[model samples]
Target: MERSEPARHRGQTAVAVVLRVLAAAALSVDAVVHARLAPGYQAAAPGGLGEGNLFVAEAVAAALVGLYVLIRGSRPAWVLALLVAGGGLAVLLLYRYIDLPAFGPFPAMYEPVWFFDKTLTAFAQAAVVILAAAALILHRRTRRA
Candidate 1:
């Protein structure tokens, strides 16, 4: 049992590293996409204060979260990482599949289209969500152990 401890530790470290890298890469992709789309979205907006600004904010948030997780591997970092990913994923999935009506102030967000931007964002966001969630679970398990 003692002889295999080092190997187990190394394996766990490798898995954690892989998860971090995966989550970071996905966040980067999504962030760039949002940044690229922001100007166009804002330009086409009714008052230039709708989805476009939201995109910019999301881009910044994603970058910060990604950088934080990529640089530091901690349970708190993982929790934040998953929260951002999960929130973005929820919005994307909802606007993709659901025909949501307009909220109190927000316009109806029923974008049932799958262009290159949408496709890339969905893929990257999904990856980030999955990897972040996995990393969080692994972290919790390690803490308990």
Candidate 2:
């Protein structure tokens, strides 16, 4: 049996709302972790575009994007969420595995260890990536539908 268009649309809307909330929550977690760790990292690498400043920037971006997704939940918002989370995740993994030297104004943020905050932030970023991707997929399908 086929579902009515309104019924299907309602289901999609519910799913989208859930995805948006989860994505925003994950972003909030990411923001909190970064903000909390920013001070120590700043002191550890005090300079231009230092590690602490980078952390503060990340936290601000995450919070803003999360707010956007929560309020708008548009395709662009989802895309931004994915990009922010994906970029953070990539950097996290890269710095975790390889000890790359400091480049330009960026400091050498290489720490080959899995601490609690780091692990938690990674998980939050990963969650945002997955949730935002799913939301974007739903947005595309809904547009087509």
Candidate 3:
């Protein structure tokens, strides 16, 4: 059975919209978690560029990217969202398992424990990564076709 062009287009649009909403929501969660924990982290690990400040920065970036994706589910938006989520997730996991020393202006953020906020942020970041990757793929295919 062959689907009509309009039907196919509608289906694609629906998928894109759903992906955009999910990705944006996940990013929002990540932003909120980081912002909420920034103050405590800053007090715990103060440095030239305190970990709390870093968390705040991440929260801002996540919020911006999430907004962009919500407004425009374009390829570029997906790329930015992917970068933010992937970078945050990588840093979180690295710090969770490894105790790396701070270089330059960064603080030593090494925590080998999984708490509520940390776990929530991790899950949200991971969700954004997956959703953004899928959106990118969908956009790429749509463009090619």
Candidate 4:
């Protein structure tokens, strides 16, 4: 059975909306984790660009990308959201396992603490990536059709 043009469009829109909302929620959760973990980074990084500033930067990036996705829904927005979430997740895993080596002006950031909030953030970031990727695919499909 073939869906009517209008029906198909409506279904696509609904899917896009649900995916967007989920992406935003996941990004928000990651942001909250960053905010909470900012203080702890001090213990790990200590006297470097570690504690307050870096975490705030991460949180701000997540929130801004999430908001941008909500408002714009453009390809670039999805790309940026992907970079933010994917890159952050990569960093989290790196720092979690290997002791961060001081590179350039940055100090070593070896934070192996995997508490509830941290775990939540990791899960949320992963979700953000998945949702953003799906939304991007939907956007491209809709555009082509």
Candidate 5:
């Protein structure tokens, strides 16, 4: 299949791709900040804000995904986005299940607030991932048909 869109739609695709790249970059930055600045941050520890290796992994993955989106178009981008989103969801769930209670003072010590923040961020990431994936899939189908 040609997999091409109308010229008018091309602009929209470009914008979407740029936005996805930027979003990935922003996430990478966030991970870096958490890993480097957050005190007591440990990958293995429950309460740690961020771990060095994990943050590096996420940043690298995100950067590569963003690059692929920009250079190769939507399908690969969608797959990478899904992986990134799933990772976020996994992190949130892990925090909820094991980290929240095991390493925390519960609702005290600002743990509850942090938990809510992370949860919301994860949800937002998942939403973006779903939207991008859907857009790519729909575009592909339309092009094929």
Candidate 6:
């Protein structure tokens, strides 16, 4: 008789992949909206860079990562995914903890609500990145056994 180890539980990995895809989609949509519907809002943000450009870059990168997840097996794909998620977390932290106050006093060109809204958005994005990183790590370790 031949025996095989039980299949691994992959709920977290599935979740991580789904989140990555959703995040990518959301960023792509935001990019389109900013370019077509909210140019003023994009220009007024703290980065001074065009929000449309930024979001487009984000979306493209994320879509590439999603492609990797779909085409590759879990090990290599997870490594790449973790790197992407970790980079996102780092960017979010840098914006929230360093860039926000450094560029303080909210530019006269932008409305107060815009500043607050961007801040909240950065924090929320950071949370998602953090969650993705942790989930990837947990999923990796779980699958190794």
Q: For each of the candidates, give the backbone clash count.
A: 0, 0, 0, 0, 0, 0
lDDT of each: 0.82, 0.94, 0.92, 0.85, 0.56, 0.49
lDDT (10s digit) by residue, model 1, range 63-109? 99998888996777778777887788789888889998767655566
Stronger candidate by lDDT (4 vs 5): 4
Best by TM-score: 2
Output the lDDT of residue 7, model 6. 28
Q: Stretches of candidate 2 above 4 Å error?
A: none
lDDT for each residue of candidate 2 in 26-86, tens digit (9 for 90 to 100): 9999999999999988997665678999999999999999999999999999999999999
The root-mean-square deviation over C-alpha atoms between each candidate and the true structure, in angstroms, is 1.9, 0.7, 1.1, 1.6, 6.5, 6.6
Lowest summed lDDT window (length 10), candidate 1:
41-50
Runs off by more than 4 Å, candidate 1: 1-3, 46-48
lDDT of 5 at 120: 49
- Give residue 67's lDDT in candidate 4 (0 to 100): 92
Candidate 4 clashing pairs?
Answer: none
lDDT of 4 by residue, 1-145 (tens): 9999999999998888888788888888888889877886667656667656677888999999999888777789889989999998998888889996888766676778897887888899899899888988999899999
lDDT of 5 by residue, 34-141 (tens): 345334444344554435445555656656665665566566676776677567567655655554433442221223335544654565556656656665766676
TM-score against truth, every candidate = 0.88, 0.98, 0.96, 0.91, 0.56, 0.45
Q: Supply the global lDDT for candidate 6.
A: 0.49
> Which portions of model 3 miss their true places by more than 4 Å?
45-47
What's model 1's overall lDDT? 0.82
Better of 3 and 6 by lDDT: 3
